[model samples]
Target: MITKNTNLFVVSNVTNLRSRVNKLYIPKTKSLLPLFEIVSNSIHAIFEKREIEDNYQGKIIIKLIRNGDESTLKELDFIDKYPVKSFEVSDNGIGLNRENFISFQEFDSEKKAKIGGKGIGRLVCLKLFSKMVVESIYTENGKFYSRNFEYKKNIKEGFDKYENPESEKTITGTTVILENFEIEYQKKAPKDLLDIARQIITHFQLYFIEKVIPEIIIRNQNDEEVNLLNLFKSEFESEILDDTFNIGNYEFKVYITKSFNSLSHKILYCAHERTVKDEGLSKYIEDLRYIIKDNDSLLGYHYQVFVLSKLLNEKVNEERTNFHFSDDEEGDSESDDDITLARIRRETLLKVEELLSSFLSKTRKEKVEQYIPIIQSEFPNYASVIEFNRDKVEKIPAGLTPKELDVKLYEIESEWKLEVKIEGIKLLDEKKDITSLEDYKKLYDKFWSEFNEVGKTDLARYVVHRRSVIDMLDKLIKWDSNQRFYNEDIIHSLFFPIKEDKDTVIHEKQNLWLLDERLTFNNLLASDKTFNQIRQLNSNSTDRIDLIIRQEEIFDKATLFSEDKFPNDSFTIVEFKKPYRNDYVLGDPKKDPVRQVRKYINEIIDKEIKSEGRSIEADKTTPFYCYIIADITSTLEYILREEMFTKMPDNIGYFRFYTSDELKYKAYVEVIPFKKVIKNAKERNKVLFDKLNIS
Candidate 1:
């Protein structure tokens, strides 16, 4: 069963061969990665032939066999529809001579070590297929020799050979037949010619560009051929750079290019001019695009980044799909040396990514800058619209697609035209020359209504700003440190002034907005200075009230709900207390928070407190809103329970009280704890802050 002339190299213990090769990893996406291994050897064999015959032209043909099972045959009318059965690769290279067969017998052979070859390409084929048939012819010792054999897992371990000095022929080549595709590898194969062709072009782009690689032809059962050289020629018309850079002891040559064909932006990693890894850099470029603008219209150019380094081969994993960790950083050793090397490797990769990121962003911006002047000169108003959109852009605003831009361009044109007309109308003389008062009022009302929407926007922004301030104030309530706290005056200064020196500076600025935000809309007559301390105090003056809020007819701020809006007639009286001031909560009838607000109401109802000749009037026929802010102490809780304030309604703070008559004078009493107010403000304000995308 064996020929004496050809070397019948027997691998010692075939099971050991299987066990050894099985340890090598093969990734799922690269089931057909064996094609690279097979072709690479063919290229090497071709080079061997070139050493003897310099004019030799290497040629490799790859053919795929389709399945003819009944299920697969049912789609006879379909094109390129059959599931793949096998692959055959034939190369006009120096055949599998004695030297080659010798190298194949060794484990981790170093014969091609200098050229970055591991001499284990056969494992890739064995992993993906059930069988291989090798046939080759070559001149050895001036004799024509041929070796032919059926290769299969767990089968005969050696090849059969035939030879004769008189049988020299004109042709010398090797044919490697791969059949019986493993079941797991079937689905990942690209059945379409274009798809597989693109994969090959992407995988072997660096090879085609740098080396005189053999002319590779791929064909299926349909007999369509894709020429690798022509494919590369069509796409790789330009090269941006071919330069070397160093990282540590490893020198890496990087090649960049712009493609006019079906090439994605990728950084291809190669070992000895053969691709070892590749990854598309689109995601990294996308990061830069998002930082520049949220708009989706910013598409960077199609480019390629190829890098070759012996370090790739030096650091390859068992699978060769990934690089291994640096020597000092392997396994689970807790040595400081491991940590240092690991950190260095990680930082090195990150630095490389950073460099690529800078290059992509600069190139993309330069490409887009060319069109800026043309866009601005022809569409000035649209330019303004773009700037406005950019100004209002949040951290993650929705990006604009082409269709959205088409719609937005029309909206921008119409809005700016309306703005031009409004400016024209403001130049009209009809306001001063109106013959009737009703016409003047009509014009005023029309303009005012148009301006009112701007007020609504301002109101929304006010809510957001106030919420931010409240969120900051929340940290102060339980702000105890080393048994220390903000004294009563420090917390009081945030709402209303505590010290007399700050009275002039803090006037009308009431930051304590616990009752409702609308309570802030009212005008302030006096705060802390008290009704009695005024320059011209009337008979109704009372020093007990901490704050006397005045509601005038119209003001700069908007009023919402029934409290601050409509009628605008009530006088809001407030009594703020330091939460630590438990003396105010004592049952000594005069010190109760409830009794204090009622006293202010009686003073306002009994007499007119005039401020600079403007009489602040309140009586049983006038409304008085009394608000009391203090700790919800035990004594106050008992008083609230006793006063039947337990059945208080919703949206109302806590307790309800009427001064003499409910129709004329009203007061809502809420004894709030500092902790509750701080927690509520933190919760509510967090929502607003998150909505605005603030950190």
Candidate 2:
């Protein structure tokens, strides 16, 4: 029997009734956000597995299985006058015992002051369901104790008179069942439940991949495991990250061993699979704007930060260094101590927010905007903002010339000066001319030549120039193609490592790679034909090849070709270096020159093989021959030689280097056959240079 009066504190023989009851409460506005609270709390519990028990493994399983039993739904309809759809979730995790259970009841308590601090996850159930039934079998001094949560007609009376059940079994897990879920206000049942589950799995992929290796098997009425990850090939991920990052008080790590597809518009996950995108970023900005306005009086790093990234195995726990000491340490000074603690916690939170902001910003800048959709698909509340004070900030014009655009874009976005960032790109949809090969060539030649030198030259400035050129070209290409700049496979293919391929062959007719997705050489061949038409007539020896450089080694070596002339009758090997320093060339040629040159040669060979797959005869080898040509000449003679013959790499070789200066000289002086200069020059050059009038 239970009784309640004016002094409504209920009493029982239970050791921690006050604590347990304090842990349970109804949230002010129970919504989807509250569900996040529950999962976050569970994640915290999993994180503490090591601290709480020996041989503890970080594992937490949350299974939501819809109930088929019509009795419960019908019974509630008849008696409670409420339609209910219930779910049962079970996990084989360390259970919450009496003391912890009591703390669970407390409001805003810091018993477990980790990610789930403030003890609000339990309230999530209140938001999701009209009725909840929670059962826990945990140890109480070697004896087993059980607890139950039953809904009462009056919520206040129910809370005051909650009861405990007696049990003999000592199990180490808790189960929660929720019923009568509804969508009210901004809270609604997800249109796609499976998608919701997939998003959860994806956002927390690194977590499952590292610790729990969760097996999320969805089944139909037949009870067969359906692979949600496999069903969505676009969302299928086979590659994983090994990279890790460390901040002052946090060690961040991410991986992607498991895969899942998200159908929800955009849901934020603490352990995320990808970075948030523009749509999500826009939402985040709106939310933050509202928050800032609502709390106008609050200042000094007081903000709510939402983290959405693939930081799965990152652990954030309280540490000894969290406490700081001041010079004055004389007395108890209780108020001072409290103030210091509060300040430390506040700072910690601020640091976390800063890290998240930095990560999302970096990702947005470095990656393609198409990927932005994927991120936005996962997290809807991570938006970008260009904070402006109309009184202090000035609007800049966009019609600025390339040089001016580069300078102005930098000035506006630089951290020290104007914080000018382009967030959520929105451009007018218009058709433009197909990008001209001449324009592409001019853009490449102008910027890359300056970027080749590092350490000794103005590398930073050169790189900035290269980046400007790339951005310009990228935009132009996208405009011409009528597509987002990054969506073009050609753009990403140019930068990312190329996957190996077969079946590509060289045809005598085209002089270009026969059929390979990765090789852009074919396009270059076609473009050359168009560009050749408008060129001024020049002797065959005067034929010129223009190149864009990207690394310091190239610039350092760029002048080397001035010392050597091109070998007669050999294919020229043009190498483009990876982005590196440019201001000053490093003097230690022995260390980086060989390694860097090797990489360049390997890329050339890889492209060649991928492009000319089966063209070479199986038996008759025609002593493959080629020449080494680069804007730079930092590689030593031995390195160049090794790269040249290099056993022919099973295709083509017997190559030599012609310094850019030598090639330039040859362009003006030599009267050699244009056919002899570039491979397949006879036919392809007509297509490439006929318009240029080279005779």
Each prediction's TM-score versus the true structure: 0.48, 0.35
Candidate 1 stretches greater than 4 Å from native: 1-3, 6-15, 20-28, 69-79, 156-167, 221-223, 235-253, 257-271, 275-304, 308-466, 471-628, 631-695
Report the C-alpha lDDT of model 1 over 156-214, residue by residue, as the tens digit. 45333333223456477888888788878877776766566666666566667676677
Candidate number of the best TM-score: 1
lDDT of 2 by residue, 5-72 (tens): 21232333323333444455544342344444445445554444446677755434343333345444
Off by over 4 Å in 2: 1-84, 151-154, 157-161, 183-187, 191-193, 202-206, 209-242, 245-695
Alpha-carbon lDDT of model 1: 0.59
- State each model's CA lDDT, in order: 0.59, 0.35
- RMSD to truth, every model: 17.2, 27.1
Cα lDDT for residue 481, candidate 1? 81
How many clashing residue pairs are found in candidate 1? 0
Q: List the residue pairs that clash in candidate 1.
A: none
**Shift of residue 407 alpha carbon in model 2, Å:** 9.0
